[model samples]
Target: MTTYNPNQDAHYQILREMLIEARQARGMFQKDVAERIEKKQSHISKYEGGERKLDWIEVLQLIEIFELSEVDFLMEFQRRVFEFNESTQTKVLQNVAKNAAKKARVRAEIVRLMRENSLSFSDLAEPPIRTRRHKSNR
Candidate 1:
């Protein structure tokens, strides 16, 4: 859900819902849409029903067939995603801020260590401290 891997994400679900809603708004059946798009009714049914994955090209094609403005469709899609995921977006922003603070602290400590030890950046990039040298097997 964090990633935009289509149908799997809420963003994609919203897009699918919009597509179905567009068809309904035009008072068109799946078969009618399929004929216009030169696809099978099952083709329309499968994507709408979530049994098949819809790609970008097909989405644009459907938007055209639905007589909806493509730009408006996309803008509306974005608006709906933001509306639905407001809480999720807030949590994501908070996590990003928290991570930025953690990174800032780590970098400050690294700079201090470099200055205290008179070490270059490469010095901090050495092998792990826990990496032990194997003794020669006699």
Candidate 2:
């Protein structure tokens, strides 16, 4: 069973509403979107109703169908979905910075290891080693 978080639920609801508004603004009916995505109208309805979750690929398809600019969509998402309080916003920014720093450290370590081993980028792409069987004396 999944525990419910009000904040997460609210975010999803906001996104659902935004998707519905975007569709309406484009003068698109649920049936039109359904045909474009090869889904039933009910599917689109469920998605817009927040009864179904939209995966990244589905979201991308919807973006294309709506002919929305990626930047506009992201700006709307930031404005609507991430309407956090001041303290929360600060915390989120801090976390993002911390994560980026950690990623940089990890990348530096990987580079150091590659240099020490004299390994090229293609060396990392090579296939895994296979074990050979040895004959045993009876």
Candidate 3:
């Protein structure tokens, strides 16, 4: 029995492994992928050699071209895809939270201005600033 060991090179090693395995399983030559994808056979060769990276769109095309239909097959491909999406979403959420803090500061400034002007809520069509006022005696 042999344990499976994938390449450790970070440059599309997984992509290359899956690409070649799927292609061979489908009886596809490198030329077939090139013809279907409108790319050169050398490009496909480089991609399968773990020397090239494919974008998401290109990966999808390759998936469809290879006719991958099994759950295990899909999971292998989608694992990296999900990680990519998750990291992208984290960045977007961080930016949104930063922008919201800035907006809150600006809103506080606006409310301070309304209080300095003694403006009512109706006068500005905005809520009046809440404050704890003290009573004075003569």
Residues 17-88, candidate 3: write the lDDT tens digits: 787888999999999999998989999988787667778778778888988755666687568656755776
**True lDDT of residue 8, candidate 1:** 43
Tens-digit lDDT string for candidate 1 (31-57): 999999888999989888778878999
Q: Which candidate wins on lDDT?
A: 1
TM-score of 3: 0.46
**RMSD values, in order shown:** 8.0, 15.0, 15.5
**lDDT accuracy of residue 14 in candidate 2:** 70
Candidate structures ordered by lDDT, highest first: 1, 2, 3
lDDT values for all models: 0.87, 0.86, 0.78
| TM-score against truth, every candidate | 0.58, 0.57, 0.46
- For model 3, the superposed segments whose C-alpha errors exceed 4 Å read 1-11, 70-74, 77-138
- Best by the TM-score measure: 1
Pairs in clash, predicted candidate 1: none
